[model samples]
Target chain A: MRLLYFAWVREKTGISSEEIDLPAHIETVGDLLRWQKTRGEEFAAAFEKDRVIRAAIDQTHARHDAAIAGAREIAFFPPVTGG
Target chain B: MIRIQEGDFDLSAEIEALKDSRTDIGAIVTFTGTVRDRGSDKVIESMTLEHYPGMTEKELARIEQEAHARWPLQASLIIHRVGKLLPGDNIVLVATASAHRHAAFEAAAFLMDYLKTDAPFWKFEEGPDGAGWVDARETDGAAKARWSAKSSSKEEPAST
Candidate 1:
């Protein structure tokens, strides 16, 4: 699956997007966030405030509990400040 | 209509296009958002608006559809600019046309309130001291919440 980072989340992660294979244990957006924290120091810092980081599954806004199975893309970012 | 581009848009032209020689429309309401020179603590030199391309358009269309579903609007337009922008530059424009003033005015406000909190765009401010991402305002979420009970559909508010 492909993962995208935006705004401050992108800055902290130091990369905009990446392709990664999800571990069998990771089934939800929350699970993916937890596993990402263990990847490296940057990922840990980027996802430290996991609750504030919003997630989108297949370009649709998603809650943390949303399933990620069969999802081609997922994105994480800070709360939008657009108008 | 929904347009997400890096170029600036003309307000008059947009309004004219929305009017589109439609004699039935009697009222048009417009709202434009511009970049501010000052942040809460410092003077901002510029702002960079970033967005998710495909998702931004899709989300705007969805918001527009909701506005149409709730009001008797003849036409509507949304234009948002991205990339680097200096203070005083226009960021977004929304226009709604209807046969009456009430529907046009309300729909324009509704679109803006929803866009502020739900759109997939972020602003990064640059100042003499440094730069940082603008924090999402609590008041924006409050503004969006005001419409929940009145909406025809009972969907949960998007997480900001």
Candidate 2:
């Protein structure tokens, strides 16, 4: 699976994207956020306020509760500020 | 038409293309968002727009499709610039054409409303004070929420 971070999340996390094996227990986006905190300090800081982060599964907007089963791509970013 | 590019665009040329040989279009509405120099208390030096590559195009196309499904649109165009930009530079453009003024105006506004929230672009502002990511404004949410209310009310009449 591939994970993408954008904007402030990218800056905070210090990477734009990465490919990793889907963890067996991480079935939902919320669970992924929780697990991400154990990765490193940057990941913890990037997801510190998990609720404020928006997510998309395979490029479609999704809620944190949304399942990530069989997904190839997941993206996390701050709420958009574009006009 | 949907374009996500780093280069500047010609507005007059764009309008001319949209209006070419389309007699069915009786009205056209267009909007452009520009980078402003004003910050809270300091003058803004520059603004940078960041967006997802494949996802950005998909979302913009989806917004355009939604507008067409709801309105009698002859055509529509969305052009959003990415990368670094200075004050007074065009940030985004939305143009809609329909046989009636009502559809044209409403669709144009609808496009912008959706783009504000739905699009993945993020703005980072640099100024004399400091540089920071622009907040995900609540007012932008309020602006987009109005349409949801309208849609729900529209559905109520049929559900009753």
Among the numbered candidates, top DockQ falls to 1
What C-alpha root-mean-square deviation, in Å, does candidate 1 show against the real structure?
2.1
Candidate 1 segments exceeding 4 Å error: B149-160
lDDT of 2 by residue, B1-160 (tens): 8999988888888888999877878998999999989966678999999998888898899889888989999999999999999999999999999899999999999899888888899999998888999877676666767787433311001010
Per-model lDDT: 0.90, 0.86
List model 1 lDDT by residue over B94-135, tens digit each. Answer: 999999999999999999998887789999999999999999
Deviation from native of the Cα of residue B90 in model 1, angstroms? 0.5
Clash pairs, model 1 backbone: none
Task: Say which candidate scores most in lDDT.
Answer: 1
Residue B149 CA displacement from its true place in model 2, Å: 6.1
State which candidate has the highest TM-score: 1
Ten contiguous residues minimizing lDDT sum, candidate 2 chain A: A56-65
DockQ of 2: 0.50
Tens-digit lDDT track for model 2 on A14-82?
Answer: 999999996699989989989988889999999998888888889888788889998999999888878
Q: What are the candidates' individual DockQ scores?
A: 0.59, 0.50
